[model samples]
Target: MSGFSRSCAAGLLAGATLLTTAACGSGAAETPPGQGDKPEVVAAFYPLQWLAEQVGGSDVQVTGLTAPGVEPHDLELGIQQVTGIRDAALTVYIKGIQPAVDDAVEAETSFDAATAVTTIPAGEHAGEEGEEHGHAETPYDTHLWLDPNRLATVATKLGERLAAADPAHAQGFKDRAAAAVSALGTLDQEFAKGLSTCKTKTLVTAHEAFGYLADRYQLKQVGITLDPDTEPSPTRISEVAKVAKAEGVTTIFTETLVSPKVAEVLASQVGARTAVLDPLESKPSGDYLSAMRDNLKTLQTALGCTA
Candidate 1:
């Protein structure tokens, strides 16, 4: 990864509120390579960008569209970003996460990671005033990356697609994809083993983002916020509070990108502490694997899980 300093890796870490080169993905910061160099791939947000960088390896230049600390569901693309979408070798995204990115991407050149797996139904959420809204409710929940197994599936497909686009690097892509799958497999086993003997399987979260995670590990998710911008209503909060209390949920979870007001309120009402759960919507302080392991520790403590 160190050799990637002047190459694509720098673009991956430098995030911002806009779509500047500094704000975009790993390779976007450098002058885009001419033909026959590494293929340029635009990943819609953080998770995809990380996956692309992992699978693409030294074969591709990856750009992340949504800057770190920004709520992806609320992302709005700049004109340059729209152009980048049209020009990149591939635009990697989950269709429903950001409507604008979905609209901007040229289908033939784009790879929708959501298509690589069998997805669950979209979560239904309501706002603070009893109004209905969602993070980006399509027919299916888009937060599949929360499950390492599902993301492993995406990585395999991404390698195939990248190889197909740049045939010369086919072997390199396959090797890297295999590596990503192995890492994810280890993460999956860790989650399964760590969460296997939890005192409570009910997960009360900041939003409906963890549906896939809960589903994978056989837990239940009670989300406080349906939309990133909207607060949960008093009635909704009360309803979740009941679930938390009944389930003996020790911690109310919040995300870094989203406000903690609702989680704090619910925690106080339910007499539980609050902990930050990285949905991996943005660049976590460490990479995805480290952050997920951190999440494992958080879950183990919050839910009283056995080692």
Candidate 2:
């Protein structure tokens, strides 16, 4: 196997072994990926699950609360999902990424001390009135996963925690984290190359969700719609058209979960086309690396990147 894949295998084995150790002593039975076993890991969403897997490779057993093809915003974890969280050694969730998961985590009195939770903010939207109220509930953007630079922070913390829980494989966790970071760096470079070559440095999107991606790639954003929490207004579309014409944007991009009506309307006015891109709030078809690579390919075409 390639070095990276080999490292992944080793880390997964080590993590699984560690989970076994923790589960045995606690009388928590080990369960396979599909089976809902306690003393396991429960991720609130897909990206977090994928990250947990990267750090907890074979040694940790994980289950995602949000299934594939499900949008995080509309998710409502049932009693069975709650049981999964209660039985896990850790639970990772992006705050504000999914209101349902955040509500469950907040009201959860049973698994308070057991699950490890992480929140990804919606850039600046997190500060709006409804989301933050305390230290356990603070105001912060929950989309940290979208920014590769910020993801390094989450990866570092997860690696340390996994190492602490599994001392025998501490070094292995660290090594895997390093590998993940390297892969993220490559993904970021691809974004940089593709976006930097675009004829226009500005992007018009159906929503403001791409702020993290735009900021990372040094591209400006002119939103054709409003916040993810709300839909677009006729005036907003007109304003976005003005910005698109002014900025010379080539395309109007829309995310998978959201409606494309606004993008189509905005595109027509500005004589631009629309493209679908995934925000990756749910479990993607591939791992994090592959998901990001696909996103890059779509961006290259949408933005007219030469490279």
Candidate 3:
């Protein structure tokens, strides 16, 4: 096996071993994948699930571990979910981002999408208050899906994996992945043009989830919280407020899944309004592309971009 494949297999084996030990006394058979001729594919979260659906099409049965509106970071895999992972023909996931999912799969046939793209170092953001609040720093930010180009890379790689798993539909997977990549390319261009002439280049978000997006668009992202669920320290809040005022930021952005109270308070302190700038974690509505475009509109309005 190739290095990547070996690593994935190792992770899956580790997860399966743990599950076996934990459920030693349980007299339940593991639930099998969907009963059909189609290949069963398990995706760790919404973004991977969406990619699998687009690429796998009718040839594969794709299941998402993280539900809509659920925070993937805090996901705890149930026994059934673990069984689903173990039984899948193929599993696609990013390692290190979701520990629970990573520890549940016996990914004999699996793909780690994070390996396909360049990763930004985690904990690079200023005013990170989650560390003080008992959240450990992630070595790398796994939110590569935020950047369309990176996601396109992942889609291409995933297509290759899906094709390998279900060779009969290889051509179909390739075709769909190409189309998806093309769409992502267009979206990337749109973001480039839209933010090219923005009045301000700073983005202040509720959490440090927008680093990839900011890097892609050449804007600076200041996160109010390091962890989405943790509240920022009083000093951190004050620091963010001062930065907002100094930058003349018109809005402080919050996400859909998390409460906006913190953002509201920060915006109030800085005399700025609060707006929803979804990270596409739960996808309040629409697919990934539409949600990203909606985010583009929000960013354009807040940054006063010409496009």
Candidate 4:
């Protein structure tokens, strides 16, 4: 088989595996009575998992479908993972971000149409041009975690859903969710304060993942190298280089798991630098707040944000 064919097959298999993984897992540690004895929550990606922890608190147990180092855009779910979701009281996912997730959501609906499936409209995209430009059909960018404001909104929504499911601790869930929203506001402020004063608001990201971040912070995403989840074309690099030069963007941000080759070429062409930006696809060993804090510093350095 040729290379493209092999890659396509690999992606399909990987996506399938991710779907299976999403369904199975050790449930939340047992909680005392009245706090919901069998409360379980399954989140499609890392950011949602973080939000779940914040809102669900000890009253609910949460697990992330996509593992560390896996790109959320192309995740696969396994049968076991699907089982976990089925067993859970609630399962939350951004419907359109990954094929694996879309498939899982569909399957869950088929299994039980009454299952709670909240679809978040991924925030609109503010960068690039043409079809590549504008909002993705996904209710919003599943990357809601990046936008503290959107995250806060989703947290509240999730809190309400979970509370209704287990009414015993409804008030507790509300309190925890309110606290999570406040924390999200604080994190959002940091990004806003840091990026607002950027010497240059234009950023060159390898993928369009930063769309929500850019929109929230008012940063201009000058150009992206790849076409959606696919790799960048050789000629596309030239257009990106021109945009980078015209915009005076000093840095091109690439994520941990993706190839930096296109970023390198784009950087060299425009005499720019490259930096690694974490997409937070998996739960950081630390909590969501910590991960955002780390990401804030990285963004600060890349965008030249200062005290």
Candidate 5:
């Protein structure tokens, strides 16, 4: 078994110890129940955590496995996080995004969020020869949260799972999910109107995490680096520069969690400025909807898009 699996198994053993302690009436060693009898949920990442909180409202105690400002693609689960997964009433995760989390969730009853929405394929920019952009061996695009409609779909499905887990709060979960869906619909409309008339239809980003958003807004995303941690080769940089010049891309966008060096280098080469186009992998200033609206303003300004 892998190290993560061993950790999870150890966590199970620890849980058993806690149970034994509880039976022996040693309150000091007992694990407390979820707050106010709320069902505990382990969310693999920020987007999933946000969805659970929105759908579950006051009825669920959600623990996010991935911390803010960390690269979700590079998360490695620790013993505490593994224990959280082993003991959660429900675990929510995107399959293939984090391998350790995937293995941990497999050992438990989980709501695979990826199944709730259709996934886009990860690939190099079309017409860019020899430029492959994607996570290590991850064939499907895992950044579904970048698109508001798909995220809304996830919220709806999460509501169903939450209702199933906590039947007494079924109506509350459904109502909150409906409200979230309506809000996402409004955000979608806003994006559609804002990007309808843009001077440039192409967006140059630091990584390939915005394909779904580009598809939704009818814009093309040219990524400077396929993997966030690895630097692009000189040839790949040349190719992206060529695309930027050809597409009249005025801004090269970088994310909060990853370094902006690659984006800055590309922007300098193409005489363009760099901007922030967050993938919403981590909560920025506010909640998911507010961060998306903030992204809309950035997109409008960078792409010269107008309503």
Candidate 6:
């Protein structure tokens, strides 16, 4: 609510182009007159966008920057998207995910979700681009959405921020956030119970995006590649194969956005099959809850969890 005016935001973009890309490129669509007098909340990608919608409820106008099926890493922002960020009351983002979105958000209106939780150290990543090409922006991994408990914490904090932004709808924001937290709590419990009796604890993924999930569920994640879009080197693939074979890994997990060729090759090398274990970087077929539930079933089957 206390950010740049429309005229001020437009004036700031002096040399902006005529063609504009909507933040709601997918999953989320803009609402008619929703943000006209309401607080405008801009989310860098799907998860944050979904959170804003859940927590802000109908009190805020939510705009998701990333489209469905598009990878959020290294996303390119257009003039309109940048303008929207400048004009928004709050711009929710994970700093290391999209470099373009990282640079576009101003401190006054920006809320980096990664700051809401304690982060783990970055893993050793060796892809075609080498180690530096990975999550080097922050010391910690930015894929915090994998853990339901941590995401619930973010939901609570986001609710507080929304309340602060729009005092008139303060109670509404807090109430919605509480409901989201309760839902996430239930999901976390399901994951804990479902993954408790897995025969194999090692998870092989094409991208090392599941560190948080692995940490939460007490499973080991052997990622073939470190960064998104970067190809895995032969040596790295071989290394993971060795680990997979040794750990009795039955499946090499793939994601929606990234190519599954590497995962398929690894699966063959380790004499295992490939399964889709969404890291949730983009919009999923269902919302976050449903997709995560699907992932739970996939993990239980892949890990051979009896319980």
Give the number of the best model, judged by TM-score. 6
Model 1 residue 183 CA deviation (Å) reads 0.4
On a 0 to 100 scale, what is the lDDT of residue 64 in model 5?
67
Compute each candidate's TM-score over C-alphas.
0.86, 0.75, 0.85, 0.76, 0.85, 0.89
Put down candidate 3 lDDT per residue, 1-307, tens digits, no spaces: 4212333444444344334533331222222335345556677778888888898888766766666766777666656546546655677888876776667655566687878998887645533554412124346777789999999999899888766755667899999999899999999999999999999998998888888999999999988887876778898899888888888899999988889999999988988898999887664578999999999999999999995
Better of 3 and 4 by TM-score: 3
Off-target runs (Cα >4 Å) in candidate 6 are: 4-35, 126-134
Residue-by-residue lDDT tens digits, candidate 2, 1-307: 2112223344344335434443322212233443222134566667877877787777656655565666666565444444444434565765545554555452321122112334433333333323322213534444556777667667777777667665777898899888887777777777777777877777777766666777778877666543555656676677778888887777888887777887888888999888887778766777777877888887888777897
What stretches of model 1 exceed 4 Å from their correct place? Answer: 1-36, 124-137
Give the Å shift of residue 67 in candidate 2.
0.8
Local lDDT at 8 for model 5: 37
Q: Whole-model Cα lDDT per candidate?
A: 0.78, 0.61, 0.75, 0.61, 0.75, 0.78
Point out where model 2 deviates above 4 Å: 1-39, 106-139, 226-229
What TM-score should be assigned to candidate 6? 0.89
- Which parts of model 5 are misplaced by more than 4 Å? 1-33, 125-137
Among all windows of 10 consecutive residues in model 6, the one with the lowest summed lDDT is: 10-19
Encode model 6's per-residue lDDT on 2-73: one tens digit a residue. 542334334223112111444423322332333345556777788888899999887766767666777777
Candidate 2 vs candidate 4: which has greater TM-score? 4
Name the lDDT of candidate 5.
0.75
Q: Write the per-residue lDDT of candidate 4 for residues 1-307, one digit (tens) a residue.
A: 2111223333333334334443343322111122224355566667777777788788655656666656666555456444444444555776555554555553321111112333333323333332222234433444556677777887777677666656788898899989998988998888878777777787788876666777788887644642354565565677778878887778888876778887888888888889877767665768778877888887788777777
Give all candidate RMSDs, comma-separated: 5.8, 8.7, 5.6, 10.0, 7.0, 3.7
Question: Which scores greater on lDDT, model 3 or model 6?
Answer: 6
